[model samples]
Target: FFWDRGGEALFAVNHLARRIIEAKTPKETEKSNNPKDTLAQEGLGILIDINGFQKKHIENIHAIAYMMAERARYFKSNIEIDPMPAFERRIVHEFLSDVADLKTESQGEGLSRRVVIKYIGAI
Candidate 1:
């Protein structure tokens, strides 16, 4: 699907998944050692570039996740919903790409946050 017509979003998300693994690999390079923090920042910049892909460019999943979680669950019920789209998720993706769990197919509110956490970790 991506090859035929998919734009940068697909590729970005795919790169994102792999980057997550890359983030973790460095941790293993030396149990006591850590990956260059800047690497995470670089990865984050790449992820931030993803934001350039507005909802108009990507899948419906993001929108659906927002509506179902924020509207139906969070604000509607005051139940705290999933608090998905976890800020930690995106920041981690961007800044702490290594820590990402590879659950990139975030459903409800999880997408925004996971993606955000990854981004912040990188930048």
Candidate 2:
């Protein structure tokens, strides 16, 4: 049996979010679908729009998130020259094109490691 390509399936949520914003599609709700429910409520859209992003352009956000995550996983550990920070900076530049203000930090003991990035008012 094949393990299957999980990345495409994983991106479905992002695509739905993209559709909700009408960037990908604007198909209305079906009979079984509730109007009250929306992509914003699903909470999978944590990777939000940086700036100048309307309801559309959701796919750009997802693409950035995927790139960031892929670059994030390349780090071996804190002691081994973590590349997460540099990668995050690049992501910020890609989204903003102007000055970039982002930082990536990793802190943990043993195998329970964590990586996080935040903006420092860079635009």
Candidate with top TM-score is 1
Residue-level lDDT of model 2, residues 1-123, one tens digit each, is 111362333345545665666543223342225444454344324333324232234455436554654444444221222333332333433553432444455555544443444444424
Q: Which ten residues in a row have the lowest lDDT in candidate 1?
A: 114-123
lDDT of 2: 0.41
How well is each residue in 8-92 modelled by candidate 1, as lDDT tens digits? Answer: 4555575786677566644433444335554543443333424444334333444433443334222333112233434333432
Off by over 4 Å in 1: 1-4, 8-25, 32-51, 54-62, 74-123
**Clash count list over all predictions:** 33, 0
Q: Candidate 2, which ten residues in sequence have the lowest lDDT sum?
A: 76-85
Clashing pairs in 2: none
Per-residue error for 65 in candidate 1, Å, reads: 2.0
Candidate 2 lDDT at 103 equals: 49
Query: TM-score of every model?
Result: 0.29, 0.23
